[model samples]
Structures are given as structure tokens and as C-alpha cells.
Target: MLDACYDTSVVQSAVDLANTLKPVRGEDFLESVGQLHDFLDDHPALGPVKPSEPAEQHAAGARWSLTEEDLAEVRSVRETVRAVLERASTDAAGAVALVNDGLRRSRATPVLRVGDGGWRTEVVSGTDRCSAHLAAAMFGALASVIATLGPNRLGACAGPNCRGTFVDLSRNGSKQYCTRACAHRVSVAAYRSRNNPG
Candidate 1:
């Protein structure tokens, strides 16, 4: 199981944006316009985040709609986020610079609210619509990850056949593969190598 520490919606949204760009078996999910829309449909946060939509407007208007322009904007942001993640894997300073630039562009501010658990902090974003909403949420998460976990935790998989990037939300920093399936495949290969001995 993934560590629950980075299990917030913001983090997951960021992860989804990065994952869509990273290839898996020669297939990239956001490679086309149709696919991009499909990705939005599949992802909860990126689709239609109605943070303050009115109930009556929802009946008469399509407030939760995505335009073609929105898709392009999101794809652009996805690329930027992916670059930052890739940099974080090897160049912490570069990653920080990139994420800082993203935060500035997003114009997201931290707001505190009292909750049942305790006082909680949230990014009160200036962007309150489709692609911009996704971008802002992703950057907010990136900022938190860089500050708390450090940028080194953002990385692409080392598995020979995998191209997915993962946030290291583990209790210990033992995770190198993106998924358990990838880890198992590597383990099986190692076992075979030891037992067979070419």
C-alpha cells in the first residue's frame, strides 16, 4: 500500500498529471485530444472541481465543462510538472526553482481553517476553473512535497519496462519501483538470475 502521508487529493492530482505524461509500454495517455478528455473524465480532481458552483446554475448551465483550449493548457502544465519531477530525481535545486516558478504563476496562497482533526491549511487559489484549477492544485501539492518530504522523493521508476514516476510516500525510503507489480517483476528476475546462473 502507498504511504498515507501523501494521500491528499492535491498530491494525487499532481501524481496523475505526471503519470499521464510518462509513457507505459509505448503508450502515453495524454497523447491526443480525445485521450486528454478521457484522462480528465477518469481523474476526479482534473475533471470538474466545483469548489463554489451554484446549485441553480448547475441545472441551467454546464458549469462543469472542459473546452479544447482547457485541454491544451492542462497538457502544457502537465509537461512542466513532469519536468520538475524528473529534475527532482537528480537535481534538487533545479526542481525547487521550477516548482517555485510554478507557485508564483499559480498565485496560490495558503489559508488556514479549523476542522474536527485540528486546524488545517489549504491553498486558496486565485485560479478557480478547469485546467487552471488542476494546475494550481498540482503546484500546491508540489510545494508541500518539496518543503516536507524534500524533492528527492519525486522520481521516475527504475524498472526496465516501466516509465511511471512516483511520489515516495513510504514510511522508509525503500521504494524504487512505481507499482508492486513492477517490484515483483524485478524480484523474480533477480531470483531467476541467482538460481539459473548463466
Candidate 2:
């Protein structure tokens, strides 16, 4: 479980979860979460979540279990999120559509919760609260990333072989690679190109 706040790891986890749905990789939910944590740690935002009025707790109830079928549906929604994020023109309308598409795919119902002295925006489903929690966590994480990295900075990796995206917080805005390895690869390629001149 993750706090519905601007925790970098949580956002990364949400993004990873979104990526897990791709056919290229096997379904590994826990692995996705772990990868997300690593990514968030690597890309630190200079800001933190501001404290707000305490959110009201919902009625205590039995925890929801995510069945395999439910997990599959969640994965599908994640794919939609990934598509929206990867697309070149992802506007507010696209974001909302992606979120709603996830809800529709999962058959999740919308519920209001009091958080940070205000209503938390989330979609819920009976007997599947975990899915709702995951969705909410993702929503919070995405919001944090957007606030921290403006649109221009949230870019896909420039590496030709990599499909990963990153929120570039670099001071000089010179972030062309997602990781040091990618940078090294690109640099070596450039050096070879210059030497070969072919």
C-alpha cells in the first residue's frame, strides 16, 4: 500500500503498473511495484507534498481482495494509462478519457472519500477495494509528477532502443537519456560516428 500523496516511489509504481500490461513482459505485479520504487528514487523531485487538513476516514470495513481476474482488468487499465502517457498529444481530455477507460474496463464504481480535508477523487467497486486503492494511488502519483515536472519535461527517453519515459528535473534541461547507461551508449555511438566518419 502507498500513501495517496506526492511520494515519488508511489508515482513510479503507478507508472510501472501501467507498463506491466504491455504484452512485451510477463505479468509481474510485485516486480512492477519494485521497479517503480527504483525509478522514483532515481528521479527526485525538489518538492514534497504540503500538509493539508487531515482527511476523514471512511467507515472501517473488510479489506478487498484482488483476484487474478481483477488483476488482469487492472492491467488492462494500466495499459490505457500508458498509452495516454506515451502518446505525443496527451491533453486533459485524454487524461480523463484514459482514467475513465480504466474504470470502465475494470467495472469499478466511483466513490468519494475525504482526504486532506477535501474529497479525494477515486473510483471504487464493491469487494474490490484494492483495485480502487491502486487507482487512487496512481492518480495521486500522476498528479505529483505533473506538478513537479511540467509538460515539456515529462518526456520519453531519447534512447532509440528504450521505450521508457522520465520526468526531467535537470537544471539545464539537457536530459536526453533516461539513465546513465543510456547516456554512455549514446556518447559511445557519437564518438564512433565521429571517428568512422562513414
Cα TM-score per model: 0.79, 0.56
Worst 10 residues of 2 by lDDT: 45-54
Candidate 1 lDDT over residue span 45-112, tens digit each: 43234334321312211344556777777778888788887778689888888777777776656555
For the record, the alpha-carbon RMSD of candidate 1 to the native fold, in angstroms, is 4.3
* RMSD of every prediction: 4.3, 8.2
Candidate 2, 67-159: lDDT as tens digits: 555455455556655664565234655664665555454454444556444654443333333445455555545544454554454445677
Residue 188 miss distance in model 1 (angstroms)? 0.8
- Candidate 1 is scored at a TM of 0.79
User: What are the lDDT scores of the predictions, listed in order?
Assistant: 0.67, 0.49
What does the lDDT read for residue 127 in candidate 2?
A: 35
Misplaced by over 4 Å in model 1 are 1-7, 31-63, 114-116
Alpha carbon lDDT of residue 150, candidate 1? 78
